[model samples]
Target: TPTTIPYVYAAEEDRCAPRHDVLIPSRMRFTGSTSFSVNVFNISLAGFACDALLQIHRGTRCWLTLPGLGALEASVVHHNNEGLGCAFENMLNPAVLDRYVAHYPVPETEELEA
Candidate 1:
């Protein structure tokens, strides 16, 4: 049997705006021209977290082009083997972010059926 560990929230978690878990697909390109596809795991007015194959160094500036949302400048804040965390250079408009989050894309099959 495998042991399960409990989860813990960070002390400063409440200081930041609430992060909403979403699966927004996007492309990220670094200043050096390195680019990769990333799935935005969560987003907030301040920043977002994404999972990507490449290893990005902290403080490296990048731009994310979200599907519905336009490109936004951001900086790498932290990273791990699985992905990197980033902070937007400018905070996103809450209304715009919320609208994008609420809009769900229709499946290809559903589109064909309709």
Candidate 2:
């Protein structure tokens, strides 16, 4: 029988605000550089996690352009094979974040039906 290893979250996880999983298509640009399209996997009032192909290192600052919300400044805190985690310079309003997440878009095909 194969044994499974339990996943352990980092100590920093305790300091983070509650996060909500959402698939919001967005763009990210390194400070003073061209923007690259990326997918925001999850978000919270504090910050967001995105999947990007660029080699963004920890402590790098960037801007995230969310679908409904405008650009917001953030700093990279960590990165792994999956993607990078960032912390917002200014926290987002909880109400606004909830609204956006609740109404996150559906595929065009699905939208057409509704």
Candidate 3:
């Protein structure tokens, strides 16, 4: 098993799962409803953050569809100007996460020495 680094959250609600920042495109839909395009910004074995301007209630059941994968069941955790944050009903596999990170990596600042 790959080791995961824990990220500290707000004092009130803390999250420990390792979070990988990416820009993977996806589709989202409320339970048994229609789906729309979304972009996943950050993902983990536990949850993911997207650019979906969800005006739904927190804890609303929803499904997230990623390319090469079927609908993944999750629920609305929160939403802000940054977009919607959701938690998966079942923890995602680490290997699966590795694939996404391999494709879309967190942007890094580059310094050139000339």
Candidate 2: tens digits of C-alpha lDDT, residues 1-114: 987531112213654578877778888989789988888877887777788755667668899998777889888877877687888878889888888788774456745664
- Reference-based lDDT, each prediction: 0.72, 0.75, 0.79
- What is the descending TM-score order? 3, 2, 1
Write candidate 1's Cα lDDT for 1-104 as tens digits.
97743111221244266777667788999987876798887777778788875676767889998886678998887778757777787778989789756763
Better of 1 and 3 by lDDT: 3
- List the candidate numbers ranked by lDDT, top first: 3, 2, 1
Question: Which is the winner by TM-score between candidate 1 and candidate 2?
Answer: 2
What TM-score would every model get versus the actual structure?
0.72, 0.75, 0.79
- Checking candidate 3 for backbone clashes, the offending pairs are none
Question: Measured by C-alpha RMSD in angstroms, how accurate is candidate 2?
Answer: 8.3
Query: RMSD (Cα, Å) of candidate 1?
Result: 9.1
Shift in Å, residue 49, candidate 2:
0.7
TM-score, model 2 to reference: 0.75
| Per-residue accuracy of model 3 over 35-84 as CA lDDT, tens digit each | 99999988988889998875878778899998899999887878898898
